[model samples]
Structures are given as C-alpha cells and as structure tokens.
Target chain A: MNFPTKVYINEVVLRDGLQLEKKLINVEEKEHLFKRLKSAGVQSFEFGSFVHPVRVPQMANSGELYSKIQQAAGDADLIALVPNLKGAERAAQLSVKNINYVFSVSETHNLQNVQKTTLESLEELHEISDLCIENKISLDVSLATSFGCPFEGEIPTDRIVSIVHQVTELNINTLTLADTTGMANPKRVFQLISLVRSEFPKQKLGLHFHNTRDMGLSNILAGMNAGVSHFDTALGGLGGCPFAPGATGNVCTEDVVHMLHSMDIQTNVDLKELLKASHLLEEIVGHQTPSYLLKAGPYDKKYPVPVST
Target chain B: MNFPTKVYINEVVLRDGLQLEKKLINVEEKEHLFKRLKSAGVQSFEFGSFVHPVRVPQMANSGELYSKIQQAAGDADLIALVPNLKGAERAAQLSVKNINYVFSVSETHNLQNVQKTTLESLEELHEISDLCIENKISLDVSLATSFGCPFEGEIPTDRIVSIVHQVTELNINTLTLADTTGMANPKRVFQLISLVRSEFPKQKLGLHFHNTRDMGLSNILAGMNAGVSHFDTALGGLGGCPFAPGATGNVCTEDVVHMLHSMDIQTNVDLKELLKASHLLEEIVGHQTPSYLLKAGPYDKKYPVPVST
Candidate 1:
C-alpha cells in the first residue's frame, strides 16, 4: 500500500468532536490531549471554533485553547473554524495560524442552520477572505453541506461550482466541502468534488465527512480520486450537529488515520496511541464513542496470533 | 455528483454474510429475500458458497437456493463463491451462471484459516480455474484478505502480484481483492489496485470490502482511482466468519448502492425498495441488523418535504 506522497491527517477532535458534547473540555485538558495527539503524528490540528459563544458553549475556551497550542508547540499549525464575519474576527484577533470560515451553499440548509441565505453567506465569505488576507492568516473556505442536505436533498453540482467560482475569485485557493449530514453519495461526491477541482485546479481541496449514512470513508475515497489531498476528522467520531440534533459524529480521527496509514498514505499517526486518545475521549464524553477502531483496536493487534516466544 | 454510468451491485447476503451467524436462515426466507432484492435493482447475486454444509449449515440449502434463483428469474446472473476444489466442483455442477474461487495470498492467513500453504492454495486455484473453464462457466478469482490479513498484519504488493501472476496464467480473467477483515487502508488499496491494473491491463477488477476498520468505502474510492468497476457486497452488512469468531459483516449492498447513486454513479437500485429488503432480512434473521440506511432512511427520502393535498 505504498503511495509515495503523504496525505495530511488534520485532527478535528478538539473542535468537531468536542463541539456537540455538553461537557466542556477546559484549556488544560485540551492542551494535554492536543499535545499527545501531536506526538502520535498529527501535523495540524483544527483545535476549535470561534463561532458565537451563545450557540457553542463547549468552544467558549477556543480563544484560550489557540493560545495554549502556540505555547505547547511553536511550529504546530492550528485551525479555528469560524461561521461568519464576526467569528472570523474573533479567530483573527487571536492571531491563530489558520482560520477556517464555513458557510452553506444549499439555500434551505443555509437559511436553517446558519440563519442566513446563500447569497448573504457568500457576502460574508468575501468579507472574511479579505480580513484573513490582510491579517496574513491561512484561510480555508468550507462549503458546508456540499453533498445532499438533510433539509434540502440533492444539491445541484452547478450550485457547488458557482460557489467555488465565487470563493476562488477571491484568490482563496484552499477549500473544503463539508458533508454536514451523512448525505453524500460517491457519484455526487465525485461529480461535485471534480467540479470544484476543475475550477480551482491549484487549490487544495479538503473533505469533512460525517458517517451518518455510513459512507464517510467512501466519500473521502471519492473526493481523493477527484484529486483531493486534505481531510477533516474528529477523534472517536464525536460531534453531533446541534442543528440536526440526532445526526452522528464526525468521521473518526483514529479510524481515518488507520485507513490512510494502512493504504500506505503516510499519516504518521501511530494507531496504538490514537486508540489511546479514543480511550481518553471516552472518559470526557462520558460514554463510548461510535468509532469501531476505538472499540476493536487496530487490525494488526486483533486476537494476537498464537506464536510462542 | 453525477457520473452517467451503470455500476453493478452484487448481493452477497447469502454467502459471506450468512456464514458468520449462529442461526441459519430458513431456505424459504433466503429465497424470498433474494427475490425481493433482485427487484430492488441488484442485477447480480453471489447466491451462496458451495462449501461443506456441515461447516456452514447457514448455507446447507445453497443448492436449493441456486435452483430457486434460476426458477425465479430467467436471466438473473447468479454467481457462487467457491473456496476450494470441492466447493468449485459443487458450484460447477450447479446450474449457476458464474463460479467465484478465492485464494488468500497471505501465507499466514491461508495457513491459519484453510490449513494450506500459499503454494498449495495456488495449485488448488489453478485446478478450480480449469474446472470452471472446462465446464464453460464464467469465473472470478477473489484474492481474499488482500488488503491485510488478520493473522498477517500487512500484505505486501509483491505477494499480490505473485498470486495474480499465478491466477492470470489460468483460464480466469475477472478478479476481486477482498478486504476480508476491513484491514485495508485506502492508500494500500490504491497502490495494489494500480499495480494490478498496470499488470493485468485488460482484466476486470472488483472489490469486496468490510467496514470492520471503517475504511471500506474509502478503499472502494481508491479502487475507482485505479479503474476498478465491479463490487461485491452483502445486504445489510449481515455476514461474519464463524470459523474466526470475531470477524465483522460484509460491506452493506444498499449502503454502497446509495452512495454510488447519490454520487450520480448510476446504480439501478431503488433506495426505498433496498431498505425494504434490509428490513425483510431482519425479519428472517429474527433480529436487527447493522445497516445505517435501513434504519435511518435515505437522505432524499428522510424529512420528506411535505405534500400538497
């Protein structure tokens, strides 16, 4: 499974995984966990979000979390998700390494989840893009609900392309398509991702998928074939969409790392230690997470062959 | 996400999936389920394994099931999975359309599970290939545990090549690599599949995967990048290996089809009907199943967007 180049495994555990849980992980535990995950080979971490404190209390300490990550590892790249211009402003004030500003392209979803129309969100995107450029922070524009939407099923490809066109025009080359609901099918994933790729040929495309429909990894595969190299995953498949209430967790981090490493796509993540993180997260979330690798351990460690020493 | 090409979905509910359970599905229920699954847009079905009935009583009525499938449809392409010479002999004798012969290239797994060395399995595979050819039956060689083996942690690409080299010398041309333990990572899948494509060139390549390590769909994506078209799956992710007690179920057919269809990869499957088949399989098995789409419903069908009376 040796593929010459390495694919980045950006840990979204601190943000995506923690956002939905009721219990807040304080700054110290966040730092300790992030440091441990880094030791297991995660290069970049989407540590938290600067979304409104009223909506996401769990991320109330993200401002503090960002500062600590810088203290812990000077070279570590940190990303904080921002939903609007104000959120982006909060992220920028912290002087973070990376700011990921998300907006939905699907009108129905955009109106419902973010309380803004698609066009309005696009306006916000322009403002955020300019602010990030002026501040010299790496900005990743995430098109949320890029696949199918639970609110609006079967999002059109043209809609996605035009959004990419809008964002790409701002000279923002890095982008992500979030499968907010487990709504993406491989064909839709391939078609939409390809459209994004063809339009932004030089852009780095990343995927943030949910396993709601159990095709998270497959969707990633579809995106990868369409020339995507980056992906977003949460540890232990944590994070329920507060909007969708019952939707499952984000695609599991250790699970993603395990698959990538096995495929010989160098994730540099030690599966044994990632499993250790799953163990740690289980305690924080106060229940077992949905990740199977967390429960079963790595493929090689299973049943331990009966060889005598 | 639209790619305008028909993707084949082969149902393996009876073979790989049923082989894992404690209770055997009655012959009537299995036939009834297959009949409905056929109508649900599954064009191909790996009817059952032709192994010893004693080893898998769950498959004690495979001969009956095959005859029923033939009687049920005039042109349904029913393929049967055959593990060795005897399984092949029984499958060849049956009035089925195709015979699938499997050989794991991993020496440790081949030894642990089948008590045969890799060389010996290849010898048996050669004989099975000849038997299918002489009988004028179409054949598919499944390289089981291809991604990684349970007993042997990582399967090398060279070993896969050696097996392919030996099998290609025989009368068989169609091939599949099975992630039998869900141990395969996308990178490994891409590299091995790419290697096989470069080497085999003209032969058809298929993938049969499990979500054990939660990377099955991603592996399929990797396969697509390397030009694989065919896939093997069980309805409802229902199988597990009884011989190896803790193994997981096969990749769910409806889930795979839904993903493809959503991606605009044309799978003939009707999501609602397939979910019905999954529900029916649950009734026959006298228990619930692990399929997400079956319980959660399709992304399009869910939240049904109301109706004007």
Candidate 2:
C-alpha cells in the first residue's frame, strides 16, 4: 500500500490524444488549450508531434502551435513526439527543447505504425538520437507496445528489456515503456518495471498507459510501486486506440490527478483547474471525454442535503 | 503487488444495477439474466430487494423473479436486500435463504433514504437479526457511506469503527463496508480495511465500491492487500449513485474478473461467458453499459493484423 509522495505528469493531449481526432484543431486553439493547462500547473507536456500532415493531419500544426505557446510556457518542459529522423529534423528546426522518439517493440505494430521493421525502427532511433544531440535537444525514447501488442499479443519481457538496453545506450533523458493498446495489467507493469529498474538503476524511466480495459490507473499505481514516477496522461481522457475503434484512450490527466491527490500522492497539479481544462477539451473535441472526474466531480465535492421526508 | 489467489464475487446487478433504471424489466427477463449469470459460474447474487414497490418500482417483482429463478439456481446463493422490517418480513415470507440488511452510516443519507436516523436503523437491525434467526435465513449487513458521504462529506474513521463493532456483535454472516458515493481512495481503503480487520479478526468481511472517481479497481486491490477477498460487482458496470447523477456505477464484474485473472488471481468465473451475459444485459437495459471489457475486449484478445500497405 506504499506510494510515492509525489509523481510527475507529462501531458500528451496535444500530441497522442489529438492525433487520431477527426477535426483538425488550428494552432490558435491548441495554444489556448496549452495556456490553460500551463495555468493548471502542468510543468511538462508532449505538446505535439512532427509527423507527416497527410498521415496525421490533426498534428500538422505542431511547429506553429509550439511557436505560439513557447513564450507562455515559461520554465515548462515542452516536448514533441518525433517518429523518425525527418520528424527530428522538423523538431530541431522549430527549436523544440525536448523530443520523444517512439517505436513499437512488436514487429507487426512497428510495421503498421511506422512502415518499418523493428530493426529498421531501431536504426531510425539511432539517427534520431544523433540528430537530437547535434541540435542540443533533450531526447526521450518511448518503447511503444512494451506491454502487449493488439495484433501480436503477449510481447516477451526479453524483447522489451533488450530494446530498453539498446535505447538506454544513447544519450537519452528518459526511457518510457508504453502500453500502446492498453493491454497491460498491474502485475505485468510491476514485474516489467521492477526488472527494468534493477537492470538500469541509473536510467530515468516513465510510463504511459491506456484505460482501455479500465486498468490504466491501477497499472500506474503498480509502476509507482516499482519506483517509476514519470507518467504520460491526456486531458479529459481524450485519446482513442486507432486499432481498437471503440476502446478508451490514455490514462486521463484530470482523473489521474484527482486519484493521486485523493491518495495524498501529490502531482502538484490543481484538480479544479485541470478539470476546467478538461471541460474546455470536451468543447474542443465536440464530444464528451471519458473522464471520471469530469462526470462525477472530485471525491470531496459536497452535495446539498435533500429535505427530510 | 501481492494479491489474493482467489476472490469471491457477489453479483448485485439484479438489485443494485436495475434499481435506478427507469424502464422496468419483467420477471422473465430477470430470470433470463439470472440464468445467464449462473451459467457463467457466478455462485452468489444479490438478486433483488424487498423494498416497497412504490419506493422502488423497478424491484416490484422481486418476489416473483426470485421464485422463478430459485429452482434453477440450484446451490447458488440468491440473496435479497431488505431495508426495513417490512422488507425483511417479505423476504422471510418468501422463504428466502439469505437476506442483506443495509443502512447508511451518514445520518443525513439514512434519514433521506429510509426516513430513519442511524441509531433507529441500528435498533431495526437488532429486530431484523432476530427475524432472520427465527426464519432460519442467513443475514449480512452492509454499512453504506463507509468511505465518504456526498452530503456529510468525510465520515470519521472512529464512527465507522464503532458501527462495525456494534454490527459484528449480531448473528450476521458477513459485514460489508460500502463506498455508497464512490469516494474511497486506495490509501483510505487500505487503512480502513486494515483497521477493521484487526478489530474483528474472526469477522467475514466484504467490500462494495463505486467507480465514480475511477478508483474502484484500485481500491479493490488495496482491500485485497489488506486481506479481504469478497467483493460486490454489477454486470456491465451497471448501477449509479442516486445522489450523484451521470456518475459511473459499481465496479464492473467482467472487468474485475478480467484484471484478477490477468494477474493470475483467480475468480473462477469465465470472462468470455460473463461477457456474453454482459451483452445480454446491454440488450436488456437497452443502452451501452460502462463496461471496459464490453468495449475493449480482454487483454489476450488478438485482433487480426491489417494488410500491409
């Protein structure tokens, strides 16, 4: 039942959450949301991704959005997702301070997501790593499908360990293990995180989870128990699994903050302000997000007592 | 990260899940659902309540439904909820083998719900205890708002401890601490359950949680860590807090079973068959439920790989 006194949240709504969205949000709107989150005490963000416009039109304005919000970010860490060397080049050109290079450990997902084999993606990660160093940008590597693969199922722990070993060899700021399709359980997360921590004691680690099977928060708890504090979450739970059409998205930022704060595990984020951002996100997305806090409110919220019969 | 190897589920969908629904399902439909759940290896059920028909019109046919399904239930535990002496009399006249007596720990909620104060409810519990023993029926007591109340806010730990001490003095078969408004966090759940366990070492205890803040599964995990094994869940995540509209309901049965099985903690319930029952429940309720497994499937389900581009 032991837990960390505090945890770090890296907001990913602008990148991972909005990537699969149908309506492409303009740069102004993205900046507006960014400023709102900044006011809500979000110190780190995966603001956007530098992928091709044709492939993911929703994130086509990454550079424009960054330019608009960078000044307002103050001391906040603004990170961009870079899928390959070209994405790295785009991020470097935009003077993005941090970049997260992501690849799937599962072969089929790697091919489907990036049109490259696992080996090819690792090669690209090397190039992306070198590019980030040359451009004076902090680099973070995320091993997607580290938990399990939607198409392949049950990824071997050895595969993730080997990938982590290879990725840690580079000059990276953090290594994140992602449950790309929300296939991880608490036991798997605890075991994998414990193994990786023991193997790479000096390496900084992060976790990204999805609530697709309603195990997202539980997995995060397990990861925290395993000594990993950094986590990726989306505002209002505004992301969806492209492969699993009706499934839910990432671990919700507001919901996670609410739960953490309730448990006395500080995230330094204001739940009320974060919920306001989540409400605004619902408007931006033109739909209700899968946020428990948004619907149920916080645990301490008091309702007026009804008249006695 | 340690968990119970096998946990018992007390299905409460028939009573709790449907009590709030506006549409009234017939006895035949209830029988159908009961048979479906039984086939899925569910051996215990809070099948229906014996409240006044005018108060809970949805459960008006509890006696008829119970009679229809009792023969088919075989050795399965078909328990009925009784909120007062009249309800207990109704259950006794129907020859019900087991009955659950529930009252709110919060005086405001108890007065608002049952037109009685907490002390008056305890007085009635003594009477009901006598009634159950005379009728040769097992009795279980559920203390609602054990975590926090929507109107009263945080219920004192001392209050709950005192209530548990009083209730365990009766001839109750089991005692359940219910998070009536879904306000229990993992830390609170762990501390409260641990305290209760130490106070009543020989008492058979259970937990009932709501997913209002998305901490239902995590709280269950914490409760398990504190040595409690029995839980109450609803199919398809049915049920809601009458005090908090639009909030999610109880911890979903199939989702809980899925996570437990994934963690190698057995529930002895077939997840796939349980899903089939959930689907039937969705059709019966005429709306999509808040079930994660219903939307995302299980972690082990392998989707066919799309044709390579």
Fnat score for model 1: 0.64
CAPRI level of candidate 1: acceptable
Native-referenced Cα lDDT, model 2:
0.89
lDDT of 1 by residue, A99-208 (tens): 88888877876766678899998998888888988999888888877876776776787888888888878867468888887777766676777776777788778888
lDDT tens per residue, model 1, B1-309: 223266777778878878777777878888899888888877888888887787778888989888777877657678888778888888777756698877677777776566688889888877776787788888888887787777767777887888888788776756888887777777677778888888988777789888787776676666766677788888888876654434798888877777766666777788889888998988888788878788667777545333325
Tens digit of per-residue lDDT, candidate 2, span A61-104: 99988999989999999999887899999899889999998888
Measured with C-alpha atoms, the lDDT of residue B78 in candidate 2 is 94
* Model 1 residue B272 distance off true place after TM-score fit, in angstroms: 2.1
User: Model 2 segments beyond 4 Å from truth?
Assistant: A241-247, B241-248
Clashing pairs in 2: none
Q: Provide all candidates' interface root-mean-square deviations.
A: 3.2, 1.8
Return the top candidate by TM-score: 2
Using all chains and alpha carbons, the TM-scores for the candidates as numbered come to 0.85, 0.97
